[model samples]
Target: MTRRRGRHDGQSGASLHTVLTAVGANVLVAVAKGVAALVTGSAALWAETLHSIADTGNELLLFVGLRRSKKKEDLEHPFGYGQERYFWAFLAALGIFLIGGVLSIIEGVRSLLRPEPLSSPWVGIAVLVAAACFEGYSWGVARRQLRVRARELHRTLAEHLIRASDPTATTVYLEDSAALVGIALALAALVLHLLTGWAGWDGLASICIGLLLIAVAALLARRSKALLIDESAPQDVVRPIRDAIVRPDWVADVRALDVIFVGPAELLVIARVVPVPDAVEVPARDLVKRVDGLRQELLRAPAITEAAVTVEDVPR
Candidate 1:
């Protein structure tokens, strides 16, 4: 039997490993919070549990996307199933909004209406701390993966997290951020409930956390939509392609250039290249090969999987 290797052999494996770990941790945390909420009747604890469940679901979706997207190019999809990854990612974002955002708001409002008495403060604190530790570890794993890319792109970690072409990068970042924020909100509600003897504040905190999650999820959805709709290439990719095609000795001038992103790390470029006299002297076959080779080499840095080049007759 022939064994098939994954598309992201090295880097993608590490990413998948980390995300799986994160999902496991979130599941554990959710179970713990659900138990605690049941025992103590704390709205804050219940809200945290719901958020973790949503996060766990999103991670599973990401894993499915990562795996499905690795399918080899077939007759139907000559370009491969790369966009399958983005489509699954969009679904994950929507799940985050619906399961995490809407449900959380509803629960928070219910707590405000029925002010349940606070339970054991110590248990809530312990669960929050444990959840925090796991979340921090997951976030750390994602940060380490991004460090190299950030340095190569000459951008800070924050900038790369928001703008990187890879959907995994954005998904991981948003999930981690939401996890931490949710913990804070849970903690705040528990403390307020303990001090003021008002369960409504705990519910209010839950509402606030839900709003924050909604905003974050919306941002993620917008970005994924951009990718799905064939958004224009990022500056990092566009600038490099322009520099490569405009190099002297071969290209005299470029009359027009157009670029579109086909996948996370793939772009299709179409250009009108006016070759110099020396370039024009080459045989037609040789010129085509040379230009194709040049294109492949130029695109290597940006993870371009395929490049097509056409040599047009020098326009009159």
Candidate 2:
């Protein structure tokens, strides 16, 4: 087995920074929104509070995932514990759906059934605006990172985000985006409640925020699940790897290749190759040296952390 270093091999610092930033922002926002919700009795503010709380908790989970994923390979897990990140991230998505989305919807329904007078509407308005600003800052950080990664991969933002293997990055970006949208919805609902004395509008806004969280949670969950199940690396990554492995003079032809993501930036590559007949006729010790050389060449690509190559006879 040949293993190479990857870009994300030691980049836990960046991922931890992003998660910590979000956790701090969401904790403050959640506290402020909770107090404002109590003062105003606004369903929208209550829903926003739940959203912030969910986000804070999710960030904590991501932090744990990042830490646990760094555990070294052991006898139990020969491939290492990298996939623990995806497992924890998947749990975080479930938490968002159950705690954030469900509770918001329930609160909205309750408010709609038994309308209550809202007091201190201005407090909710002020709190929501501040929360938007905070969430916006967090969103900006994630967006910057996303843009950098996308440029490196030569893919559009949407395309890169959809196929990204790092659950921490994707989760933070999606959570911050949802938080911003939820804040906007809360602001609009508060404004409408002030304009018209209808408590139903506030409740409706809460429902909208809940639905948005559900959609985001679903997407995150799907991505995490795919990662846990061992999805293949993107073509952009695989093609370069194949090209690199096939360039040597001793490699006559590459008959088959399979590349799968074993972790955020780790790939498990298995290939079958046909050697030049002259090269194959060499002594066994020389053949071993040539194959080792070929493996080393494949390892030069940063993303191909592990490679297995088999020499096969040319097909009739």
Please write out the lDDT profile of model 1 over residues 1-316, one tens digit for every residue: 1212233456667668767877888888889989888877877777788888998998888898878877887779766676776887888888888888888889899999998787687788888988899888887877777887688778898888767666875687678888898898888888877788888888897888788878988888888898888787768767878788877468777777777766666666777777877788788898888787777665565455556556666645
Instruction: Go through the candidates in order and give the clash count of each.
Output: 0, 0
What TM-score does candidate 2 reach?
A: 0.96
Q: The CA-based lDDT of model 1 is what? A: 0.78
Could you give candidate 2's per-residue lDDT for residues 1-316 as a string of tens digits? 4233335654567788888889999999999999999999998889989999999999999999988888776679766777888999999999899888999999999999998889999988988889988888888888877787789899999998988888887899999999988998888888888898888988998899899999999999999999999998888888887887778888888899999887787788889888888877799898888888888777776766678888996545
Listed in order, each prediction's TM-score against the native is 0.91, 0.96
In model 2, the Cα lDDT at residue 242 comes to 80
Among the numbered candidates, top TM-score falls to 2
The TM-score, computed over Cα atoms with residue i paired to residue i, of candidate 1 is: 0.91
| CA lDDT for candidate 2 | 0.86
